[model samples]
Target: MLITSGNSMIQSLADTAFAYGRREGDHDTSIPDLTLHIRNTPTEPLHCIYTLSLSLILQGSKQVAIDDRLRICSAGQSMLTTFDLPVISHVTEATRYHPFIGLVLKLDYGLIAQTCTELNLERPSKDLRYQAISTQDIDTGLCDAMSRLLGLHLTPEYIESLAQLYKKEIVIRLLHGSHGMHLRHLASVGSPSRQIVQIVAWMKQNFAQAIGINELADKAHMSASAFRQHFKALTGSSPLQYLKHLRLQEARDQMLLNGLDASQASGVVGYESPSQFSREYSRLFGLPPQKDIQRLRQA
Candidate 1:
């Protein structure tokens, strides 16, 4: 049974999100770092990158997967992604009459660190083994704060001054919630998780460049084997596997958004052999580059 506050918060968020996200795509808001998503029908599994953010399901449900791990988030639940991760996700439940509505807020690591300091949050002695993605019931306080943030769309005048405070409240509530430990580790200095996050950020900026596990491990200041263990534990994939997923996702974006052809997209994302790129792309996305792009366009 949902608490009364939780139920009210869901209704509030759903109503506000529908007002802004009436169309069937992501809607960027005037509020900094916030986006709303609406879907009228169940969608095919989509391969994309989820940055450090919190996604709250206001209505319906969805399934998200990273490597072999899968999580299902229903209404009143929220998913926290502590790192920028390449994930496969699809709407699991939705209909035209009752569309899936969701709110996504980008998380700022700097703000998180500052909030931790202000709150005097202590670092955990050992970095707990946690995946980059986690799902939990939305805290009532956090849900209410999100509702207010979305409601700001109706009153744009105060957005410039008030949005940051609301965003900070959301982060503060997040730090006090179930996913707090994972987040705390991300903010803690010299933690393996934090180091891995740094490495992931570097990989994202230089994904098209040739990358080696040893080089990445060195950057993380860990031996290759330890780095591999921590990386897999946190991201659900090894360093090389994560890089491959990043490259493939980027190539897909290039083809879909920039009108790049399959071979061109392949080479642009650092694939030396178009055939090899096509093989891996097909394996990951279930279609060759051209067909995938065609399908996406037709959608």
Candidate 2:
């Protein structure tokens, strides 16, 4: 039956992924765009930004919350994010015997655009908007392509020659899959969604600096009101709210990874008031900066 074969394919993919992501952390493969994640235990909600990428869950499960929408992706499924959006995610199922294994492939917007033109796909109306994230069952074709993509690591010499081909195949599969319309909408030149994506990329780089919504709207060539509406529709957050999430997440990273204390991290991330930073940090992360960093370290 179709379901039986699908499960088998997923298991094979899991095996391939585990071979590379054997250690309990994120592994960057020789392929520049491909990364693998391995986790042996459930985790606290970790906040971060997801760029244009496809994350395939080969084993176990994860819960990803974007704004108010929460999606659960288990084995045999994948999550596609069309733009840069701040998200909170955590492993929901994993164990020493059955660790969670996942593969993340950074998608190329240029390639998506090229594929759309080659296929003559109709662009969605500029007035319409789509959510930045979606989850769907991975079809057999996509699974096979991904498995081969991972297998390319074994023959590194072939990777340089064939990786782009496989990556293009994966993009084509996505274009025909559930996320096709959304991807098309975002990749279309001069679309509002595409403009918002560019703005989000800018936000990521300049998050540590003070930003104004009107300034960003001008950069996107939209009136303040129109920009705000499109931005919210696509990312599920207002411009200021999204910036807050970015700053908080960056501050947490500084404290956890760089040994910055709460005040120092807050200042580094552009929070003028340490008290205000602690308040917002606790609101978003469920603990003060010091406590949250300590918990993450213990985990």
Best by lDDT: 2
With a 3 Å backbone cut-off (N, CA, C), the pairs that clash in candidate 1 are: none
Query: For model 1, where is the 10-residue window of minimal lDDT?
Result: 1-10
In order, candidate lDDTs are 0.88, 0.89
Candidates' RMSD to native: 1.7, 2.0
Lowest lDDT block of 10, candidate 2:
1-10
Q: Give one digit per residue, the lDDT tens place, for model 1 in 176-263.
A: 8888888888898887889998999899999999979999999999999999998988888889999999999999999999999999
Candidate 2: residue pairs that collide: none
In model 2, which regions exceed 4 Å deviation?
1-6, 125-129
What's model 2's TM-score? 0.93
Top candidate when judged by TM-score against the true structure: 1
